[model samples]
Target: MCCNENFEERNKGEKITTTLDLTEISGMNFFDPHVHMTSRTTDDYQAMADAGIVALIEPAFWLGQPRTGIDSFIDYYSSLIGWERFRSSQFGIKHYCTIGLNSREANNEKLAEQVMEILPSFIFKEGVVGIGEIGFDDQTAAEEKYYRLQLELAKEAGLPVQIHTPHRDKKKGTQRSMDIAIEHGLDPKMIIVDHNNEETVKEVLDRGFWAAFTIYPFTKMGNERMVEVVKQYGPERIMINSAADWGISDPLAIPKTAVLMKRSGISLADIELVTYRNAISAFAQSGQIDEHDFIKIKDIDQSQKFASNSILRGGQQPRIDKNSIIIS
Candidate 1:
């Protein structure tokens, strides 16, 4: 049977039920442009590697609750460039990150001031790709204050920007996000407007900013809708990401969406562009990414440790079974 074939068995005079298996699209390289790896596990890393994910970017985001101090932000940003980078590399995935004060957290006026003070120090770090996952959460004046500051920060650092559009009044927020970026004299081509939908995609693309869709299970963009988006947009500056985090989400959303795109008759080159290339081109403005280096799979030494932390525990050895049905 072909790998992409639906898994089903026929019964006399009965309808057959089938399940979509993601493994069908195995070996296709993917790069999740926006995900929260700090909220993921080692098993998630292994599954991503198995699905042929070559690289990913974990944007600094709210930690589900408000952090109390500027020192907390410092530690969190340190982990993104330190521990998280090492963890992803152990699974043969090159990890990159974007640092900024998330919009929700920006509402805290007291802490927001301190965060802005500390952001400049981290924004220029080695693994830092851009200033992002930044923009309006509730469209508050404080959020806008920090948002514009980070836009200036990106300009000073000569890095790209990632804008997080608001969930409520999305169309208005999406437009405002672009308007603000342009107002700051930042070029649209150097910005990535994320969490976009059908209503916002056209305007974002028309304005020349990259539009990134997050394919979540019950909310945001679904895989079926993504196929149609590709059909409508034709893949120029369009990209998809799992955006999986501590919430209810799937880490394999990129590869799974790629499978759905193929089943829907999207061409391989277009699939490659939206699922992988577009993200690289958008973020490579930081001059931190070299497509050739990241596209190649690095050697995985699961036994390797960073800061006294390894992917293994209890002296467990690494397992490499791609087809084994056994669950340990």
Candidate 2:
């Protein structure tokens, strides 16, 4: 009998069954190399912490709508490095960010020009990891112009880049995205080509770029397909992310994928590399990350404040019982 079958037979009369429990993957540290915490809430952070997510990098992307002025970009970038960082720390997860002009916003040439000027100011800030979420959205000339400019900025700043592949014509766009980065004379290892699928994965890995998969529900790559990708191609430069944002998405996708991958027979070591270590190794190029720091026990002190902002609300005290049934 199979291991699962044997276990089920042993517990025949009990309520136990062969179904895999997600908790089986607990206590394993995870680092989501790409996620948008600015669009998320405090509850997500707490859940991520509970799920073994040690650190995450939130790349700058379109905020579901276009902003009309340069000041909006400035304030948005400020919050990434300021309030967002503070909020994540309250939940004991380290938050790092990438600053860039997203492709959708880049089409506004008038505003894109001004936004480019200010990117330099935030790119080198503390906790800022790289230039990212900065590739083709609609594959327009304006998008290409800013994408190339940001690539140059990333090269100039000696930082890694996170490329967002176009959802439509993804295969062609993925190829072009790699070509441009190579044309700029940037090393493939320094670039992370994200939002990949079966068609784009082999080429990305073959080209020596870090291939990041966004496990989104009902769209993008699903968990079952992700397992097949791992089964076909061993985890080397491959990494998985939640890429959870303001839309309908699961913040715990990484941990949940870990569960599925485990059930699908992917080894623990391989799972760890794809879900955590690979992301750390890729972004550690920024020289900002210390893996040791993440491995330590990160204690959360709710009393801490940043710019007068706390995780608590309106003078409410911190709840001590996470499992309490009472809702106040």
Candidate 3:
């Protein structure tokens, strides 16, 4: 998710209002290509699986606060490919991630240079689907400097690029992101423009980039608005995501939005296109993922460990009940 200067940290004790009938889209497969699971709990993983999400792509994003040193970025990126991947598998979801210097962090030139150095070591590593959620935050010179560098990285590596359009001046940011990618000699088909809205969809599609909408509760596009976008655009290279993070976001948003798409008379073929197929078609260009990647993930051996650490604690048992709603 992109940074919003107006947003404040909320108290976790506060109640989150959600739609009542999220189960209507059950039994369908979803690929939320922009969720931040590091900030969510095991309970959210269980809920996403219960909602029919077979796999997801967690892109590198701002973590809601400034990370002080290069070690922090290194540790965070390591978790995305290591413990976080293992954790999602324990709960029956295929987790893949994009590796890059995020827009916000790129503004810090010295730290950004250090991050750029470490990126080559990780971008070509396993489970890295693309170089992304990378684009303008405030559209500063430093952001553009590293943005171009990562674009070169993705092209030379033969991986796709996931673009994060800005929260403010979204239309202009979305347009400029595509222009720059094109100018860099990257194919439009290789770019995934995210956080899109009505103001930017047509141009994104016309330019041949995959248009992705974030189904956030208030600040971004909502489920109702998403349905109309599909109705008008007809789901050609268009997909939707939750973008759930350490904010007032919903992890079960794709399923919930599919329910609305069904009730609104959107066809099942169209629904599956936007919710699942489009995501696979886009990121699979990296030759890093395929049909077998997300196939039937369940009944994992929870006894597994990452770097001598287990997802399980002292008295907690491994989860075997897929039908149950709670993770633990």
Candidate 4:
């Protein structure tokens, strides 16, 4: 939380420390439109708040290991909209999620079919944002099949689509993701292309889709490059996210990058546009997000329980810190 503090983190489950300074962007709060809090911990929630993250979007994604049954999917989806929402609320962080059968998971045709049947049941729930983190992984035929199907679901439901472009051949995959969405008659405004890089940002922006960049420390899309992306493109429909998970990732990447962007001469308004406003604007189409909800913090009671479960443990006193957070 201080300048160049050695913050302990996990890199592929290995403990290590990454220096983070929330100094520059302390009072400037942000919104990470894509992060996997289910794969994170309470410590992360605390640090995120300290790092100025006020709201976030968790997209239902690949759980690393493949899930065999629909029950796992159901419970996982429910947790994001229920327990995760509750946990984030305890921290005064507004949480919203996108539900979908991921690209890799879509390859399991039988399970994918079952998932599609259950999608409608959860997509309309409270804190539910839209159909997302759902696009191409390997860009397989099966991935395409469900991708188109989910686009139809999003269109019919009048919700936004958060797309995950493939790790390999991302250009073709990103183009295809947009192409299919258009072919399905989805407006570009309703589609958010995530995990974007230098290669695909122009087309994504030029075509009118929200281009989201995920900032990581060592690889993928790092913060330095992100600053240049904003410098060249300007922050119109562009957004930034942490995309933090159980692996080697920084949960505070958005604010950390904000600090770097500020030092690199990006104006505060441009920084907020990419780090906050743009994300909310892209997803607000769902009617689930309200600026007033997380725009400012009020008192948060750790004693409050969701389904008789509080963040408190045995004999632990509930704290009414308006700026604290916890997740089990």
C-alpha RMSD by candidate, in order: 7.3, 8.4, 4.8, 6.2
lDDT of each: 0.87, 0.88, 0.88, 0.86
The TM-score ranking, best first, is: 3, 2, 4, 1
Q: Report the C-alpha lDDT of model 4 over 232-315, residue by residue, as the tens digit.
A: 999999999888876678888888888899999999999989999998888999999888878443234433334565554322
Clashing pairs in 4: none
Which candidate number would show the highest TM-score if scored against the true structure? Answer: 3
Worst 10 residues of 4 by lDDT: 1-10
Which lDDT value does model 1 have at 137? Answer: 79
Give lDDT tens digits, candidate 1, residues 65-120: 88999899999999999988888876778899999999999999899999999998
User: lDDT by residue for model 2 over 203-243, one digit each (tens)?
Assistant: 99999999999998766889999999999999999999999
- lDDT-based ranking, best first? 3, 2, 1, 4
Pairs that clash in candidate 1: none
Model 2 compared with the native: what TM-score?
0.87
Error of 3 at 150 (Å): 0.5
Q: What is the lDDT of residue 84 in candidate 1?
A: 87
Query: Which one wins by lDDT: 1 or 2?
Result: 2
